[model samples]
Target: MLWPNATRVLSKMGLLARLAAHCDSNTHFLVRTSSGKVLMKIALGDFDVPAICVRRADLLAALLSALPSEQILLGHEFRHLEQSGERVRIHFADGTSKEHDAVIGADGIRSRVRQTLFGKSDPIYRGYLIWRGVARYEGNAIEPGANSESWGAGKRFGILAIGEGKFTWYATLNTLADHSDSPDGRKSEIQKEFAGWHAPISNLVDATPDEEILKHLAYDNIPLRRWGVGRVTLLGDAAHPCTPNLGQGGCMALEDALVLAKCIVNHNSIQAGLRRYGSLRYSRTRHIQQRSLLMGHIGQWKNPLVVGGRRVVTNLLPARIFEHNLRRVYSYELPGS
Candidate 1:
């Protein structure tokens, strides 16, 4: 999910038109109970730029298309790194090595670059698993340009329309870590978990082929005290991984790229640029990490009383408050913009 802020960044890069062609511009965000009771509705259209939903592959294709083909190295798996005085040498699993002035670890949550820089540490499991799938639904069961998340006891289901009669859905359930399903049983398990949820959810699951379903245990790292040292630094999930509660994992990474670029050009040396990037990003990403964790906890509430109270509180809260919060997130601008 690309929020307004991320889209704005892309727009500045001149890639919005290409990306928007494959995405659906989201206008409203709806929060509801498992049985389809609406608790809150947030108008995303109030923002200057609209939120967009696109398949990850589509987004990647759009981004890759904008870059030169030869510049991208395919099938290179990072194994470790060695940093000399002013250069960093990267080693890949294929026994290949390369040297560069600086290394940016945008690798991801299990970043090998991060481990080589900081000591190896496992990401914390947030006691939940998420299953994602893309399905084709021609029915008008779901409203166009609307994204909705339905909350149940210890489970949550989110549906995002990604244009062209395709919708992306994610289901989350509180569970022990490192859980696995039998061969080809992921779709069945998800269907069973969300069996009684509202309409279109089941429809989406049914439409998706078993092989297309993807499942993973949700994990995130505690905010790092430092993102990089010397000529090596981290970005996105490598620096701070957050739960998907806010749908900002990718969005934050987009923001980081822009800020990091600006910082590098504005600073005198590579090390200084990396330092400024980490310092500028630390507080904002930390706050988002903490906020997303809290939201996941609240959404996973299982007790009837607590869930009822949450719904009541959310419903009673003024729309302006929600709008203000959304604005704070979506209104972010690149430095000196």
Candidate 2:
């Protein structure tokens, strides 16, 4: 994803350092087994890639606050959309309507805007769900620059430092679709599910407050045959939702926002801009989405033998190979950046 723009925007607003100070700059990506044995440890520091972790809400609020108040809308539930001539009209659930030269639907995975454009397409569930939460730990419980993911049979847990003495953690489990679990129910279930896992896996779950826990089933759209139709277009997850396996879902959307803006500014017409944006983004986004899905499948292997084989293969691979793979993803920059 194009992060330089975000860095520039936040820097201009004097919030970049503040955000950096709060986020963990983890320089290692560790893949471990359920027994707490490290299978692969990729030294991200060698790649010179700066990993920034921020709670999505915090980042959004910071960005929104940086925008001019008069230019931003607070709350409105989008209901429907209509196109007339070169303009697209968006109708709000409250009966309000607005028109624009182009409409960029960024309403997320369950996007009403996407439905308005694509006619009620639903996301495909990936037969697993993730429980996420942030826990406050004592000094360096999850060290800064040490991000780890432990894969178990049909389950996985990840811990990464998000802030000083604060680590954001997630656990994924194979499950039936739409478990309909309440917050408390999910907390209890996750705790039980990860009970026998290594230290800090259990500890993080135990430390997280009930209200802070979040649970959701993983879902992604089948690669869309098209991103936009006319003056109406899509962005972010609305355009290409992907499994969280690669942790690039949000970054991909940020990349989309950057490229979309550049395409529009450089194009002669709105339609041309939308076309350029889709053309530039479709292949890259589709590739990442497919890779993420594949990684999820591998990471969630239920068979002990297969899981062991995966670990052995991962461990045997030279560190440079892992670094090369990561560089392919992280080294991407906006066309002229």
Candidate 3:
């Protein structure tokens, strides 16, 4: 995910240096080599976000510096939760309830508000799975850059530069349509999926011990009917559970938070503002969610004919067209009017 715009937002708001200390400027991206084989490669993705995390922590501390000691509490849990129009009432596990003007659920994909207000939907398991691991390198062992994904029939792999002498790589594969799994089943699945891949992928997978490998059952949430039901609002994976194919899951969450904050800051009535927030966030997120699923299906195609179909489309299209299509998503802004 490209994050220069977020850094600009921080810089404009005077949080640049705080963010720079912990975040790395390195990035890696997906690309095809001239030899026409899919492999781990690099481009730019981590250019300016993780470094900003330092500033974020500092700001949180600085904001908390003025608070009185009596106001701090820990080890609390919610025993009961209730939501009405424009506010959420949280009943403590202990018999206390507090009402807030608006509640934002930024928790995660299996968001309670999303399930409660919108109801839980079954996660659509695409006929695939993934393996991930991190590796350390020195002195540009694989070059300097981020944004790399090597696509192939029924599988693809990408090595993302996370800065600080490390990289994160994950590979996705098409399993049997009905293959359910177990704790150790993923190892066998990976060995089968990647056995035919190139040397770089094979090397990376082989270099890592089995214990370090992470398994993710590929899934996309069913599209919800609403985002914010009332005074309550949902953000991030709670709002739109995007497939990792596009790598915009985190980026979209960040955008949702910014837009929601901006909307509340600009509007007088919290309810109207949050409703508008839903309207504003819904279409964009839904489009991204659907497109990502579509993209994943395309990448995970198993048949030779479908594989050729994708290649034809990818070749017939200019790289600029892909860039242009993504630019609109990458370059979004809140409506100022």
Candidate 4:
């Protein structure tokens, strides 16, 4: 999910137009009960920039297409690194090494670069597993540009239209970590879990092929006190990994790339630039991480009384109050923009 802030960043990078062609511009967001009753609705069109939903592969292809092929080296697994004065040398598993002015670790959640900089600490599991799939679903329930998430006891499901009659759906359930399903049983398991939730949910699952369904146990790391040391710095999930509750994990990475580049170009030295980048980003990213965790906890509530209260609170929430919080997130501008 590309929120307004991330879309604005993509526009600055000159990739928004290309991606917009194949993505769906979501105009509204709805929070509903498992029985399909709406508890809250927010008009996403009120924001200055539109929120979009695209297939992950499509978004990745757009990013890679904008870069020169030769500059992108694939199959070079990072092992460790050494920093000497102004130069940082990165060693790969293939026994090859390269020296650069600095190193930026965008290698994702289990980043080797991050481990080498800071001590190794495993990501904490959040006691939930998520199943995601995309299907060519056409129905009145899946209105164009409309996104919805339904909450049930200890479970939640989300649906997003990704243009061209394709919908991306995800279901999360409270479960133990490190659980796996048989290769052919994934689709059946998900269908059983979300059975009789709402219209089009079962339909979506049934429409998706068994091989297309993917399962993952949710995990996130505690926000690091510092994102970098010397000539090495981290970006995206490597710096501050968060749950997908708010759909900002990837968006934060996009914002980081832009800020890091600008900070480097504006500073006199690489160290100073990285320091400034961390300082500028720390507070905002930490706040997001905490909030996402809290949301996940609340969404996973299983008690009958607590779930009732949650629904009431959401239904009674003033539109302005909710809009105010969303505006703070979506209206963010790059420093000096």
Over 4 Å off in model 1, which ranges? 182-184
Q: For residues 188-298, write the lDDT of model 2, one tens digit per residue.
A: 888788887877887788888877889888899888868898997888899899999888888788778778888889988989888888888889889889989998999
- For candidate 4, the 10 contiguous residues with the lowest summed lDDT are 42-51
Candidate 4: segments with Cα more than 4 A from true spot: 182-184
Highest TM-score among the candidates is held by which one? 4
Ranking by TM-score: 4, 1, 2, 3
- C-alpha displacement of 205 in model 3, angstroms? 2.7
lDDT of 4: 0.88
Q: Write the per-residue lDDT of candidate 1 for residues 1-337, one digit (tens) a residue.
A: 8898998988877888888886777888888888887888888756666688877887898789889999899999999888998889999999999999999999999988889888998999988888999999998768777899999888999999888888899999888896878565888888888888889889999999988889888789899989999999999999999998889999999999999988888888999999989988898899889989998999888888898888889888876677778788888876631
- Candidates 1 and 2 compared by lDDT, better number: 1
Model 2 misplaced regions, further than 4 Å: 1-15, 45-49, 139-143, 182-184
Question: Each candidate's TM vs. the true structure?
Answer: 0.95, 0.91, 0.76, 0.96
Worst 10 residues of 2 by lDDT: 1-10
Task: Name the better of 3 and 4 by lDDT.
Answer: 4
Task: List candidate 3 segments past 4 Å from native.
Answer: 1-29, 33-80, 83-87, 92-97, 138-143, 176-192, 207-209
Top-scoring candidate (lDDT): 4
